[model samples]
Target: MKNAELVVIPSPGVGHLISTVEISKLLLNRDHRLSITVLIMKLPIDSGVDGYINSLSATATPRLRFVDLHLPQGDSASQPQDPSSKSKSPLSFFANFMDRHKAPVRNVVAELTRSDSSSRLAGFIIDMFCTAMIDVANEFGVPTYAFFTSGAAFLGLKLHLQSLSDDHHQDITELKNTETELRIPSFTNPVPVRVLPSVVADKAGGSTMVITHARRLRETKGIMVNTFMELESYAVEYFLNSDKTPPIFPVGPILNLSDGGDDIRTKQSRPIMEWLDHQPPSSVVFLCFGSMGCFEEDQVKEIAQALENSGHRFLWSLRRPPSKEKNKMQLPSDYENPSEVLPEGFLERTTEVGKVIGWAPQVAVLSHPATGGFVSHCGWNSTLESVWCGVPMATWPLYAEQQMNAFEMVTELEIAVEIKMDYFKGFHGDEDKKPEILSADLIEGGIRRLMMGGESEIRKKVKEMREKSRVAMAEGGSSYNTIGRLIEEVMNSIA
Candidate 1:
């Protein structure tokens, strides 16, 4: 019989859901006395996490339960409003969407408590975006712990900025256009304003919502960051040293390396693997942006030219941009004919040296022996995956906290190559404004340096971090010990 029960609430996106599930599995595997119930919140549009959820349910233990919250009919939470409206930001939309689920979530918690006599409801583990659910946890008189799907450095940045705004009463919106550098405690170097997350840097967008979430983090029982101390020693140490922040646990490098199942491997990913099988080991440069990353025709052509000119074997996952129709969800679609966006005759010319495909098997590709260098969007999950697989990256951050992630890896960690530190493809309606295009020459230079730099220090560092990542997840590692401490605290809360 389970002794203690934990309810986990995760945000809708696949990246967030994947990390949340991995962490939950880690906790369940570590302590037999613990049971977890994950509350699923569906996205306004189909983000394709349902298949993954179903697979998990098929293999899940009795102690692990998934409860899907019922959405009210005609409830439009994540739908985009008028651009001129104050609630136009996507961050605000997501925050509001999660806020609407408070009633259902509270009811679910009440039911769990009522149904189980043997199991005690220990706490609520909430996703970073689900901070509003803390209110539900409070109503039940249980502590809430935040599962930060991002790295410790980004977590520290959020807390520090929130403190500056709330405690110091400073107007952080003024920092959007300023060229000044701010010295953050987690970072070794002065951080430039341009490298800030677009949500925080954009004055008219989601800065308020972002700051609100950071403020709520301080109220949590403890914050669990999805990064290992060995990888982010300084940031982890910074949180440990600061008394103002709640107890911080760096229990990660938490990754979902599974490519669904064998059927997916044989059907969807066979071609990609077959191609990689032929390439010389560590000869191909793999370029794949995250799920939401895509570009226009102009940017697409520049990248094609760069790959062709670089004269290196390459595997590129190029996606078509989402529909421009008003009130439509902005998700990347697969191109019917990629040549329409590429330079004329480009595919035929480079067919021998490269392959351009849509919807890559990212984890499988990263783990492949042939994938030497990665040209990535630097999403936190992608960053951790690259490190876990020992692949060096050339960073090209498109949105969210990715620019800051790129800055940390390149400038702070010195493990990744820089493609463009401050590349911001604006979120929500901001994409309408034409962002500066990266030229082919600059792209080619980054690719060449990443691929042909020849046993460089960056490569060596990534290899070393890969080993450290393995050690952290092993028995008696830092992340293992941190998880143990977290479980102990939850058990103690029962007394």
Candidate 2:
């Protein structure tokens, strides 16, 4: 069992890929006896994952390695095209890719097994989206685990949904159609169905996909979550005691030690870093969305108007939606001159107080001493990064599970202030053409509260959570021991 190897196949997105890679790193570090090989597929547009992977591999132990896997493409004409939208929906495309590529990926796996007899396949751990690969593991008579990207609360809720699938009760489909709150475990307050991720709230038949995915998770060897036991004691407890659940590993708050590792951050960080140096400690609020944090033209204008009104020191990383060819979740490049769409003279007027950059070196910016608060889209990864940096947030969830994440941060954790709580992107219809629901006044108020300490009383809370995250990853901490427990379980099973 010492050299037993695990195969990891991640979904084709930067968030999933990076988190999964981090898990691989933690696993290898925890047990020198373990080995891992990651199978990857490419995103149509680059979001720096390739470069990150290269750097990781260069420094990675010999026990850990990666290989690229290709998926066959289906007809483009058959794809769903949301006209008037700059970013095309990637859901169907990925779903189709999974279906078409499953066979070939299995063939590759079978061949890899034949060639590497010494490093026997111990098991498979895959992104929730790559559930199809479970079949390949089953075919090879191996166990499979699900690497869920979100927190334990989300998983507890998903397990609840799975149990609701029996007779006399409805499945996720019926739950989506209802107007009641869901009684999910691990969270104190009842969650409004609308605030739940689209899988349970999507009116567009998308919940059906989520339901299917949740069902698939039930069949895994276990589901690994990126949260620590301390941060989610309620959740870890709930799942562990729940019936019909697999082993739950709260193996994170897995901190990324340094950011600004890629060439992109290095090239773009000079100006942003310089500006941060001039500011007072913990004074500036940095506004950035995750890779996909683009706004409609009017929304951008509203944000500009709000910043001018707030009169707070700020650095806004404004982004436009990429053309159909790019990764929607990427940080966007800003206007060399932002005055192009700004209320005229907005740049010069706020010159002393605010700076706008296309791609503000996020990790660098967030980690800087001057950044105190974040106006964010509340992507889970970005949320974790902010917590790790000890910065508080004003949450603005746009799409996907962002709304749910926003809710968790604000209501559940009380670590963030809510900007526009009930907002849903698809509800506006013709997504890109959707009107801005958040007025300048509302945005301004949220910023003021976060920066000035109103109900956005996040300064003390975030600092405490940040320290918890650090301790949790340190020796003898909850996360560190969680990894050890997981390694022992895997070893015992194979032994």
Best candidate per TM-score, number? 1
| Alpha-carbon lDDT of model 1 | 0.88
What TM-scores do the predictions have? Answer: 0.96, 0.91
Candidate 2: C-alpha RMSD to true structure equals 3.3
For model 1, the superposed segments whose C-alpha errors exceed 4 Å read: 78-87, 261-266, 427-429
The lDDT leader among the candidates is 1
- What are the lDDT figures for the candidates, one per model? 0.88, 0.77
Per-residue lDDT of 338 in model 1: 91
**Which lDDT tens digits does candidate 1 get at residues 146-212?**
9999999999899888988889988788888679899889898999998997668556656787789
Residue 392 lDDT in model 2? 92
Expressed as tens digits, the lDDT of each residue in 1-495 for candidate 2 is 446879899987566888888889889987788888888776655667787787675576778788877654554423334444545445565676677657767877788789887777789999978887888889888889888888888877766776676423665666554678877777888988877765464455466567678778888988888887766777889888977688888878754555526666677788889989999988898998776666767777889999998888999887665554543333455566666767878888999999988876676788999998999988777888888888999998877778878888898888999898656664223253454568899999999888984423578889888899899989999888878887887787778
**Residue pair clashes in candidate 1:** none
